[model samples]
Target: MSGTSEGQGPAGVAVPGSIRPSVTERHNFGRTASELRDYRAAFNAAQLAMAVVDHRGLVISANEALAALLGTRPTELRDRYAADLIDLASDARTWHAYREVLRGRRSRFRCTRRLKHPDGRALWAEVTVSPVPESGTVLLSVADISDRRELRARLRHLQMHDPVTRLPNRTLFFERLTAALESSPYDQGSTGRIGLCYLDLDGFKAVNDTLGHRVGDRLLAAVATRLAECADAGGPGHGGGHLVARLGGDEFAILVEDSTGTEQLADLARSVLAALQEPFDLAGQRLSVSASIGVVERAVSGTSATGLMQAADTTLYWAKEDGKSRWTLFDPERNAHRMTRQALSSMLRPAVERGEFTLEYQPLVGMADGVTRGVEALVRWNHPQFGTLTPNRFVAIAEEDGSIVQLGQWVLRTACRQARQWQLDHPDVPPLFVSVNVAVRQVWDSDLVADVAEILAETGLPAHLLQLELTESAVMGSAGRPLQALQALSDMGVHIAIDDFGTGYSNLAYLSRLPVSVLKLDGTFVRGFQDEAHANPADETIVQALVELAHRLGLTVTAECVETSGQASRLRRIGCDTGQGWLYSRAVGPDRIAEMLGAGPRPQAAAASG
Candidate 1:
C-alpha cells in the first residue's frame, strides 16, 4: 500500500511529515521491524474484514478476510473505489456521510448495507470507516450481520401475525394504519385519503361454543383465505394493495391507502360480506356465517388512526343493529345523533342526583261528564345543556344503564307527595289522584311493591288514589316476580293501569286473570277519531271492543290522546270511562291542575288557549 506522507487531521488541515506519527509509533507501538511483520500477519488473519483506503476513497490494501468476504482476490480489490466495493453510494445520506469521513470532516462513519457476494448471495454487513493515525488513510471494517438480521425478521413476522390464520394481527394493523396517517403529503405517489372496512363474523361465538375451538380455528383459517382474496381484488387505484389483518377473534380489518372514495370502500365491504356468506365446509360441519361491516373513507389530513377506528367501530355496530349480514357507511348526521345520545346516557345518573327532573300532570277526565277524574304524572328533564327533554329522549338510556331504578324511585316519591299535598290543599273539590308511569325494569330491578308501600306511607297518601301506569307490553307478559309484584300492589288498593293498551299483545283472556284495574287505549286508535267525518269505524270498533272487554273484566277504560271535542263526544258515546289528552290540556304544572279542579270541566277552547 502507498500513500502521501502528509496527513490531514479531523479539522481538514494538512499535517506536515515532520509532525506526522511514524509507522512504528502508530502501528507497532515503537516495536522492531520483525514485530511489525507480526502485526501485518495478525491483520491478515483477523476474522473481521478490514481494508486500507486513502483520502481519495480508493482502496490501497485489503486483508485476506475482506477478500474472502467479498468473494474476490486481494489483488482484485486493490485500487478499487471503497465506496463502490461496499455500495456506500446507494443512497444520498450514506454517500454524504462516507464523503465526510474521507474528507477528514467526520470522526468516523458507520452504517448497515446489503452486499452481494461474487457467488450471488446477499449478505447484510455492518460497515464502519475510521481514520488510520497520521496516514491520511482510513481503515474500513465490515462485519457479517445477515444471521442477526434474518433472526430479527423472523421474530417480527411472528409478532405481527396471527398464528392460526397466518394473517397480520392487530399490532401490525395499527402500525400500518398509523404510518399511513403519518405519511407526508409531499411523499411520492402519496394519496391524500384513506379508507377501511372493519367487520366481524356474526354468531361466531355460537360457532366456537357448539363446534369446539379446533373446528372454529379451521373455519377462521378458511375465512381468512377468502378475506385475503377480497383484499387483493379490491386494492386501491394506485395498485398499492389493501392490508388485511385479523384484529383478534372474529374481528378483522382491511385498510386501503390512497383510497379513491366511499364507493371504493363500499365495494370492498360488499365483496367481503358476499365472500363470507358462502358456507364453510370444515370437517363436514358445513358451518354458515355472515359478517357486519363498517366502511369509513375520508381525507387523511384531518383524522388520526384512533379517530378513524372509532368511526369504523361505531358504523360496524350500526350494521349489526340494523341486522347482521350487511354493511353500513358512516353518516355524519347519524353519528351526531349517536353522540348526543351517548352524552345524555353518560350524564343520566348524575342528572338524577342533581335533581334535574320534574313532573307534569295530564288530566284523565270522565268520558260521561267531561269532569276531571285524576291526573297522570309525566316526568320531564330540565337538562342544563339541552334545555327541557321529554321522557322519550332519555328514558331508554336510563333503562339501559339501570339508572331508571333511581329515577323511578324519585318519580314515585315526588308524585305521591304531590298528590297528598293536592288532596290536603283542595278539601272542597274532589280529591285528585296522581297516576305515575312505571318502567318494567323498575319492577324487576327494585322491590316495586315495597317501594310503592314506603312512598305511600311516607307521603301519607292512600294507595287507592295513586295509580301506577305500565305499558301494555310490559304487563301482558307478567310472571314470576313481576306478577307477584303486580298482585301485591293491586291488593294494596293502588290501581294497575295498562298504558298504551290495544297496541301490544292485547291478551283479553290474560287481562281477566291479572289484577289490573284500568286500560289506557293507545294514541294511534284515538288519532283516528280526530273528527266525526274522518273517524274510521274500524278504529272505533277496535276501541269499542277493547272498552267492552275491559268493562266485562271489571276494569275501566281511559282513552288517550283525545285531541278534539268530536273525538271526546264519540269516546263518551262509546262508554270510554276516562279520557286523557290535549283535548283537555297538555301536561301542566300542579297549579294548572288545581285551577282545573276548581273551575269545573275545561271549556272546548281552553286547552287550545293554554
Candidate 2:
C-alpha cells in the first residue's frame, strides 16, 4: 500500500480495480500531507493549547503549545480525554456540548472554560472544537483571553466613574436607574415615576480660584463620598433606591426610583445640602461649599431620558439664579420662558443685522436748572414675532454670546449720529451728551477708543458730547491695557461716566483715579431717600457723604430713579447735579427727544425739584 501509484497498486494489495486515479489526485495527497505537517508545526509553536482527539474522545496527539497552556508536559497529556482537563464541577454543560460534537450531532463547539494549570493556577480559555471525520479525529483549539478581558474591565471603569471625584458618572447612574425602575414593587399607579435631584456647588469657582486645582480636586472627591453616604442613608426602603453621579464640573445628579411624590425628593435634596454644609479639609486647608438643588418628579408617561435631563438642567439654572443653596422644582411655565429667551438670544445677531433694533433716548435732566442736560441712549428691540423688547431682556444675553461688541458699536454710531442731529436741531439747549452703556467684554475685546473716535469723527459730533456709561464693576475690573484704553478715550475728549454705582466693590480710592467725569448713583440709594424718615439715618448720611465726596473730587453726581417730586427734592438737597429716571420722562424715540428739546424745557415739578 505504501508503494502504490495513482494508476497501479501492489500485486498482493486488494485494490479497487474500477477506480483509476490521475496524476492530479496523487499530487493532491502529497500537498495535503505537507499542509498538515505545516499546520501541526505552527500549532505546536503557538502559545495557545492545541490537540487532536479520536472519535472515542481520547486525546490522540497533543502539541507542546497545549502542554505549556496546561502547565504540563505533552507525554502526560497523550491519550487523555479532553474533558478531564476542564473543571467539570463548574462547567458540566460545556462538557455535554463537546460530547454532542463527538456524537455527530454538532460539527463544532465553542465556549469559555476554566482549567487548573500544573502550577495550580486557575486559568480561563475561549475554546473551539471541530470534528475531522476524514482523519477520524476531533480538533480542539484554545486561546487565553485574560488580558483582553482585563482591558475591557478597565475601559468600563473609566466610562462609568468620574476621574476627579471617583464617583459614578451619568452612564452608571442611568444604568442603576433603569434597573430600579424595572425592579419589583414598582410605583403604585399605571403612571410610575422617578425623581432626580440635580445640584450645583455654589462658590466652588471661588475655591478653585483661591486654592489650586489639586486642592479643588481633592475637595470634590471628599464631597462625592459624602454625597454617596447621604444616598445610602436614604436607600431602597425609603422609596426604591438612590443613586448619585458626578455630572461634570461641580454638578451632581441623584436618581431616586419609585418616588412617592416630590416630598421625598425634597427631603433628599435637603439631606444632600446638609451633607455638603460640613467643611472639608483638603491639603491642610479647610474649605466650605454649598449646593443648590433642582428636584423634579415625573410620571414615566410623557417623559424620556433626554427630556428628563433637559428639565433637570433648566431647573438647575433656576436654582442658581433664585439665590444659591436652595432647591427649585421643574415648572412648565418657567421652562417655556427660558425657551423663549433662548430663542431670542439665538436670534439677536440676525435681528440686529435685519434692522430689528431701534434706539430710544431717556433725558438726563440738570437738577439745578431743570434743563435736559443729555439723553442716555437705550436700545429697544422690535422683534418680528415677540414685539418690543427692552434692554433688560437681551443685553446680558448679547454680552454672553459676544454679540455685544457689534451691538455696542451700533449703539455708539447711532447715538453719536443722533447727538449730532440734536446739536444741529436744538442749538439753544446746552450741547446734549448722549450717554451709551459699554459692556465689559466690549471694552476688553475691541479697540473701544478707536471705535469712539471714529464714530465722533464720522458723525461730526464733539467727543465730549458723546458720553460712555460704564458700570463701576466693569471699570474697576479693567487691567493695565484696558486702563490705558480708557485713558486714551479720555484723552480723545470722550466723557466717561461710571453708571450703576454703589452696587459693586466700591473702592473710592480706585474710583477717584479712573478717567471718568460723572458718577451716576445707583437707584437703590435714591430710592432710600423716599423712605428716609423711617429708614436708617446712616442711609441718608451715606448718600450725603457720597454727594460731598463726588463734589470734592470735582466729579458730577447724577441721582438715578427720581420717581417723584419728593425724591427729587431730597436729591437736590443732597447736591446731586443731575437726575435720571421716570420723573422727567420714560425713554422715547429720537424724534420725540428732538421734539422735547424743541418744546423749550417743558416745566415739570419733578425735574425742577432735583
Candidate 3:
C-alpha cells in the first residue's frame, strides 16, 4: 500500500486501479484472474443494460442499467430467467432462436422486444445475446430503443393509412387482400370467397363545389366512422373479418375475407347504401350524400387481387351509368364483353395509324329502273388480329376516343378517289354517286367543309358525285358551329343526306331548316314491310307519311334494307326514290363493285335474301 497510488473514496475508503501496479506487472502477479475481474469494472458501469447468464438461460448477474430497465434492483434480477424478464417467448421465432442459443447451436443473435417492468408497464428494448468465449456462460445486452421504434411505427402508420379519414389506404388494402387470398384454403377446390364493395360518393364533387372542401373533409370523416361501425356491427352478410379503407377522394372500400356468398356481398352493398342515405350533420350544415357501390365476390383461389379490383372498378362505372345510389354485382359475362370492347377501343387509334381500315360499297338502286344509281361507302376495319370487323364493333370506340375524325377523313378520301376511278374507267353512260357516313364528332371537331373541299379537289371528283350523310339526331337541329359546318359543306356543291331518319328526335319542325337533300329511311320500317306475315300495316302508313312529308320538304326519300322485290314494290308505291340493303348486295369491295358495274344492271332477284 505504501508503494501504490490510490484515490480517496467515501469515508476515506481506498479504491483500486489508482492503487494498482502496472497492468503488465499486475498480470504477471499470481492474481492474473483478478486482473480480468478488474477488466469487468467498465462493463458493470456501462450505461447499456447488461447481464451474465448461464447456459440454462438464467441470469447469473445484472448491472444497474439492467435492473433499471426491469424496474427492479440488481439483486432481485439475479436468478430470474431472461425469458421471464423480456417476455421473449411471445414470438415463436425468437423463442426458437433462444433455444438454439442455449443448445450452443448458434453463437449470437440480436432482436428488438418488449420487456415487462416491475410496475407492469412495457419497455421496448433492443437486445443482443452472445456466447462468452471459452466460457459456458452467455452475455446479454439491452438498450431502450422505444423512441426510434415509436418513430418508425409512426412513419409506417402515416405511409399505410389515409390522412383525411385515417383509414387503411390503397396500398395497405392491396397488401391485406393479397394476404387473404394467399392464406385461403385452396386445396378444397372451392376456396372461401372474398368479397369487396367498392364505393364512390355520388355527386360528392357537387358538395365540394357548393360547400368548401373543409366541410367535404368532415363529411368524409363522418362517413368513414359510419362505415367502420357498419363493418364491426356485422350488417347483412358480414361473417367476421371486415376492413374499411379509404381508396382516395370520395371513394372507399370494404373487404370481406371468407365471404359467405354473393347474397352476403349484395347485402353488404345494400347496408352501405342505406347507411349513406342518411344525411350527415357536418359543420352546422345538414347535407345529404349517397354512394354507388360495386360489389364483386369470387373464389379466392383463381382470382388475383388486381383482377378483383379491376372487375370492381368496372362494375362501379356501371352503377354510375345506370343511375345513382345503387349497387351492381360483378357479371362475368358482361365483364368479358366489355373487356373486348375496351380492348378494341385501345386498338382503334393504332389501327387507323397502321392503315388497317378499308371501304366496301353497297348499291342504292333507282326504284323504277332497278338500276344502281349510287353506292354507300361503308367502312370496315381490316384488323390483323381480329380479322374483318364491322362498324358496330369498332365505330363507337373510335367516336369515343376522338379517332373518328381521322377515320372518317380516311373513308371520305378513299371513297372519293374510288368514285373518280370509276368515272375514268367507264367513260360511263351514267355517273353513280358515292355516299359517305359522317359522325357527330367529325362534324363538330374537324373542319368538315374544308376536309370535303380538299378531298374532292385532290381526287378530281365532282362534289355532286359524293354525298355526306349524317344521323338524324346529328342533323335535326342546325345551330351555331355544327349548323354552320353543314351549311358550308352543302354550299360547296356537296349532296347532304339524313341517314337513319326519324329514329331520333322527330322534331319535324326543325327539319325544314337543314341542308339535307335525301332522307334515308331506317331499315326497321322496311323490314317490317318485307312480307305481309310480319308486316305491320301501321308501318306502311308510317312509310307513306314519311315519304309524303319528305317530298313536301323537297327531300328525296330512299327506303333502306329492302330484301325482296315485293318490299321494293311496296317502297316504290310509297314514292320512295331509291332502295339499298343486302336485298341488292351485301357491301362489296371496290374491285367487286367495278365488276358489278361492267356486268350490266343485275335486276333484283325475285325473292332476294333478306
Candidate 4:
C-alpha cells in the first residue's frame, strides 16, 4: 500500500490478469508483444502452484494452478496475502523467513506447511519464496507433498513401535527416557524425578518352547493391552501418565516421567503385578504367567538413562534370585555392596600374582597339656585400598571366578614352607603341624593330589605336618573325582581334617569310610560353652557325643573358638584333643607362634586355658 501506483488495485495488490501485462512491460523491456503473450501463456499452463507476491506480501497475480491448490478461483485469490492463503503464517519461524524474502533481505525461503482445504481435506505443501530482482515482487511456488509425508509418517510409526504388542519399541523408549532425564524441573511438574519398572515375564520362555511363538505373541499383545490401560490411569493428567514399551522378547518397561516418589512407583509396580496375575486365554489356550519387576525411582539431576536402567536390571536380578513373581525396589546400599564384591572379584587373580596375600597362624593347642601343638594357617589379603581383608571378604569372590585354585596353591606352599622352617628353627620342641583350609573348588578345578605332593616335596615338610582342612559341606558327599582326590591325598601320608565339623551334611556314617584323621568342631558349639551357669547343656552334650564318636573312629577332635578357661576345661573333659581360639592367641605372625612354641619365653594364655 505504501508504494501503490494508479493502475494497482486496492491495498496495492493488483488484479490477477491485469497485473501480468504490467509485470511483463516493466521487467521485460526488449520483449515484443508476441513474446510477452507467450510468456504469460507458459506461466498460466505451469502445473506447480505459482503466485506473484508484491512487496507488501499481497498476491499481485495468482495462476489457475495456485488457485486450485488453495481450493479457490484465481480472481478470488488476487489482492489477498499469499502467506495467509497457504497457511505459511501459522508457524512463526516460517512466517519470519517469508517476510525476509519479501523484503529482499534473504535470497530465498523454503519450508513445508500443512493447510486445510475448503473441501474438508488436509494438504501438505512444500512452499518456496524467492525475490525477483527489479520487479519489486517475489515468486511463491508450492508443491503438494501430502502423499510423501503420509508415507514417511507411516515408516516412522513402524520404526518406533513393536508390531506384536503395538506399543513403543526399545528405540522410542530410550528416546523418551533420555529426554525425560534431560528435561528441566519446571518442565516435569513439581518433582523432576524419573521412575522405571523393568519387567520380565517369568516362565515366558517355557510357553515359547512348548506352545510355540504364535501363542507367545498373542499373550504379549494381551499383556500390552492391559498395561496400556493401566498406563492410561497413571498417565498424563492423572499421576503423570507412564509410557509402556516392549523392549524385545518378553521384557517390557514402564517409564514414569515427573514421578512423585518411591511410593507412587511402588503402587504402580504392585498394580502391574496384580494385573498380570489373571490367567490369559489366547486362542483358547489358557495360560498363567507371572512377572518379576524391578522398580527404581530417583531424581533426574544426577541420574542418566543407562545408570537408572542398570539399577533396575540389578534389582530385577535380585527379585529373580529371591524367587520369581515378585517386585523389588532398588537399594543403593545393596547395590554398593554388589559393586564392591564385583571389584574384589576382578582384583582377586591379579592380587595373587602381585603377592598381596599373606598368612597368619592361630595356635591349635593341645587340650590336655595346654601347650601349642599345631597352628591353623589363615589367609589374609593386604589390599592396597581396603586394608587387611579377611578371607570372608574375598574368598567367595575368588571361588566364583576360579582364581581360588591359584590362590589355594599359594597358601599350601607358603604354609608348608613356614611349617618346615619352624621345625628347623626349634629342634627341641615337637614339630608343629600347620592346618590350611582348602576350598572345594581347589579339588574340582585343579589337580589337588599333584599340587599337594609338589608343595610337600618342595618345602621338605612331611604330609603329616601339613594338614589340609576342608569344611563339612565340601568333604561330605564326595564321589568320583573329588573322592579320588581325597583318597590319593590321604594315601600320601597327609592328615585330612573336616573343618567346621557339625555345620553341614553331618553324615556321620560316611566319615569312617573316608580317610579323615581329625574333626575341627565348628566355633558355634564352643561359643555356647560359657561359664558353668551360662553354659548350654545341649551344646556340651553334643560336643561330648561327637568327641566320643571321633575317638571310637580313631579321629582327633579339635574344638574351635575356645575363648575362656571354663570352655577349654569343658572341651577337655569331653575328650577333645585340641583347642583353637582366643583362649591361646588371635591369628598372629610366624614369629609370635614361635614364641608360643618356646622359641622365647611364652606369652601367657589369654584365659590361662588351652
Candidate 5:
C-alpha cells in the first residue's frame, strides 16, 4: 500500500506514474483546508462590502456586507452580475474598467461609483476592483461617500453667497468680475472695455431711523433681488452680460462687460435708476427708496480692479453731492470739483469750531406802512479760504452730516441776541420780531420747546418777539410726538409760521389744527402776481383762498417777493396781512434797522417807491 496508488488526473483519467499520499501528507492537507475556511469566514464578516466575481463578470461569492449594501441575501448575489447592482447612468467608463480588471487585463481598479439599492434610493460607493488571475476571480471592496459629497456642496454654497441677502457677496462679486474682465478683452479682439456701476441707496439711513433695522435688512434684500433682475434683463442679446452683486449694507454693484461705448453704459445706468424708482413693499408698509449710480467705462488694458472700484466710488459720491437719486458718469473735471467740495465739507466742522460762521438778517416789512416788522435770519460762513459762503453753499452739507442742529441753535441764539440789542436801541418804535428758520432735524433731534425757551431767557427777549419759521412740509410731516413738541412751543407764546406754504401739498384742515400763527406765501406764488391779468386765474384764486382761509383760522398771511407796487396793491386788496420784498427794503445790519426804526414809518408812496 505504501509503494504506489493510482491518482485521478486531467479529464478524470487514471495516471500510471501517480503515487498515493502517506498519512502525514493527508493530515497536513486537512489542516491547510481548515485554515482556508477560517480565512474565508473572516473575509465574509468585513464591515465594508466585499464581493468575488469571475473573469466572465459573474459574482461568484458575496459577503454579508455586500448583500446588505445591495439589499439582498448573500445567496441571491452569489450568482448575479456586479454590473446589475450598479447605477449604469452614473458612469459606464468606471464599470468598463472594472470589467477589464475581472478579465485579467488590469491588476487593480479604484473609482467612485453610484449604485441603486433595492429600496429605490441612490448610494455612493468608493469601489476598488482587483484581479486574481490564478483564482480566476476579482475582488471588489466598496465604501459609502454620499454624506461627504453633500457636506462639500453645502460649504460651497455658504462661501459664495451673502447670509443676510442670499445674493453673491463681495468675494464672489470680485471673482466674477475678474473673469468677466478677463474674457472681455479677448472677445473684443483686444479692444473691448468693461463698465462698472456702483449704487448706494439714498435716504436709507432715514428709513432705518424711522423704521427698525429689521425693516432695513428686509428692504436691502428686496433691493438686491430687484437689481439682480435688472442685470438679467440687460443680458447680451438686448445689451450685454451684466452681473449684479451686493457689496454689503445698502451698497450694490454691477459689472457690464463688452460695452461698445459710454452711451451703452449710460443707458444701463439709466435703466438701473428707472428700475429702482419703483416703490418697495416691506412688512406691509410701502416705502420709497432711490439709488445714486456711479458709472465708469474704460478699456480693460490699463485699469486695475481697485482703480475701477475707486472711480466708481468717487462718481457715486458725486451723484450724492449733486442731489441724490441720480446717476453721474465718470468725468475728470467733475470729479475734481467734487473733490474740492468734499475737502471743503470735510473742513467745515473744524471751521465752525474756529468761529468761521456769522448770521445776516433780512428785513420783512408791512406793505401798507413800510415799516420793518421782522427779519429773517440767514447763515453766512466766512470760510478762511472760500470766504463769505451763504447758507445755500453749506446748509445742505450740514444737514446731511447732522451738523445742522448745532448750527441752527447758534443761529437762534445769535438772532435773538441781536433782536434784543435792536429793541434796546429803539424804544419808541413798533415791536420787531426776529424770525429764525428752523430745520427739520432741529425739530426732531432736540427738545425744540426747551431750546427756544432757553434762547429767549438767555437773550432777555419776549417769546412773542421771536418767530420760528418751519417749512410747510416739515410741519405737516410731524407725527404724534413731534407735532406735540411744536404745539408745546406755541403754547409757550412763541410764534410759529409755516414757511414756503405753496410748495408742499398742505392740508388746510391739518394746518388749521396745528398751533401755527402765520402762513408765509411762497415766493413762487407771489412772483405770479407780477402779471395778474395775464397769469392763470387759478393762481390768484388760490392765493385769495389761502388768505381767506388763514384769516378765518385767525392766522396772519405774509406775501413774499412783492417786487412791484401793482403786485403789492393786488396782494393788499386780496387781504394779504403783510408783504416782504424789494418793494420796501433789502436785508440790512442792526445799524440800518435801528436808523429805519428811528426814522418812523415812511409815506405809502415813498415806501412803495423805495
Candidate 6:
C-alpha cells in the first residue's frame, strides 16, 4: 500500500509511482485489512471477465468471473500469457497496439478478439487493456458478444437469400457481381473472365395458372436446388465459386467466376438444360419445365453489374424468340438493333404527333382485264433517324404498344381523303377504290363501323369506294361486338376484304357467315409459280383451290406478292379476281396511283412484262 502512487491492477496489485499520488489517493489506498477483504469479495462477485497481465503480456492474476468465462479455475489462469487467452495472430495490428501499450506510448488499448474457452466453446470478446504503467502490469476487461454476432449473421443471411428457394437473392447477386467484375482483369487473363447465364423458365406462368402458386413455389425450389448442385459441382471446365441466384419468380442466374471462355459457359448452359429436363414433383402433380438462357461473357473491364444484367435480359428474350429451352449468346450487333427497336417503340406516340407517318399505294389490279381497280394503302414511317420504314418493321410494335388503333385511324382517314381527292381529280374516269388495311386491334378497340362512317363522311368519299382489308383470322374470329361492327360496316356499303388468306387456319364454313367480300391469297401460294408451269405445283394447287372455294362462297379472290410474270399469269389463270404486288410496281405515292389510273388498263402483255 505504501509503494502505490495511483491505480490498481487485478486483485489490488499496486503499481508504484506510476503517477503523483494526492493526499486523497494515499488515504484511499491506506485501507485496513478488513476493507481489503471487502474489495476481494466485490471482485469475486463481478460478472465481467477481468485479469491483470505483466509487462511481458503474461497473466498475473484473475477474478472468479474471468476463470468461469474461460471454463477454468481461477488458480489455473495465473502465470499465463494474456495474448494466449485472447486468440489472434502474432502480427495483427492489435498486437502492435499491445506493443504500443508496453512501450508507454499508449495508456490503454481496446479491440475485438476471438477466444477459445476450455470447454471448446468459441467466444467473441470485446477486450479492453489498461496499463498500470510503473508496475509493468495491465488490467484486461472482456465482454462476450457471441449472441449479438450470431443474431447479426442470421439477419444478414435473411437479407441476402430468397425465402422460397434459399438461393442468393437479386440484392446479393448484384453485390457479388459488382465485386467480381471489379476484381477481374480487363482482358482474359489468368485472373479469369466473367460469365453470366440468365435463365427464365418457359411456361412457368401456365404452371402458376393451372397448379396454383404453391406448386409453382415448390417447382422453383427444386429448380434452385438442381442449379446450386450444378454450380457447386465445379468440375474440370465448370470453374469455381459459381454463384446461383434466384432473381425472382421463375428466373434465376449463375455467375461463373474465373471463366475461361464462351465454350465453358456454353457447357454450363447445356448442363443447366440437362438438369432441368427432369420432372418436378409438386403438390402431387408431376410438372416438367424448361428454361431459356441468355449467356453473356466478357473480361472484367468496361462492364458493370447493371450492364451485364441488361445484356443478359436482352439475350434471354432472343432465346425465347428463337424458341424456348435454348441458349442465345450475346451479340452486340443484334443488341444494337433491338435497342433501336425499343427506341422506335418509345418514339411511336410522339412520332404520330410529329406526323412522321405517311401512306403509299400498291395497285390491286383486275387480273382478267389488267386494269387497276383499287390501291391498297400501306402505311410507312418516315423516321427522322431512319429512312422510310416498312410495316414489317413497326406494325407489330404499334400493336404491342396499343398504338395500332391510332395509326389505323390515321391511315383510314388519310386513305379516304386521298380517294376523295382522286375522284375530284378524275371525275370523268371510273372511281378507283382505295383499300386501307385494318388491324385486329383497331376493330376490337371501339365501334369500327362508327369510325369508318366518320372517316368516309369527313373525307366526302363514298363507303363503296373505301375497302377495309382485314387479315383472314380477324374475319374468321370476329364475334360479338366485332362481328356486329363488321356487319354494320358491310351494311354501310363499306367493302370488307380478308387479307393474307390461307396463311391462318380459316374455318371455311365461317367464311360464308362473315360479311367479307374479297379474299387475298397469301404470297406463299404465289411464290410456287417460280418453278416452270408444272414442277412444284403444291402451292399453285393450293392457290387454285382457295380461289375456287372463294368463288363458290361468292367472295372475289385477290393474289398478293405477285412479283414475277409467271406468278401473274398463273394467278390470272387460276381465276384470281385481282392481283396486287411488286410485279406491277412497288408501293408508290398517291400521285403515281393517279398516274396509273389516268393511264387506264394496259395491254395484257404490258401488265405482265411491266
Clash numbers, per candidate? 0, 1, 0, 3, 0, 0
lDDT of 4 by residue, 34-111 (tens): 576687787788998998999999998888898888777888988998878888888789889999998889999999
Query: By descending lDDT, how would the candidates be arranged?
Result: 1, 4, 3, 6, 2, 5
Give candidate 1 misplaced runs (Cα > 4 Å). Answer: 1-31, 45-47, 65-73, 103-106, 186-188, 237-240, 600-610
- The Cα local distance difference test for each model comes to 0.90, 0.83, 0.86, 0.89, 0.82, 0.85
TM-score of candidate 6 relative to the true fold: 0.78
C-alpha displacement of 574 in model 1, angstroms? 1.9
Q: What CA RMSD would you report for each candidate?
A: 6.1, 9.6, 6.3, 6.0, 12.9, 6.2
User: Could you give candidate 3's per-residue lDDT for residues 523-550 as a string of tens digits?
Assistant: 9899888676777899999999989998
- For model 2, the superposed segments whose C-alpha errors exceed 4 Å read 1-191, 198-240, 243-253, 273-294, 314-337, 428-430, 477-479, 531-536, 600-610
Which 10-residue window in model 3 sums to the lowest lDDT?
Answer: 601-610
Error of 5 at 537 (Å): 1.2
Question: Which scores higher on TM-score, 3 or 6?
Answer: 3
lDDT digits (tens) for residues 182-217 of candidate 2? 655544543377899999899888888988788888
Worst 10 residues of 5 by lDDT: 9-18
Error of 2 at 324 (Å): 7.3
Candidate 1 residue lDDT tens string, 339-391: 99999999999998999999999888988877787899889999999999999
lDDT of 6: 0.85
User: TM-scores for all candidates?
Assistant: 0.89, 0.63, 0.83, 0.89, 0.56, 0.78
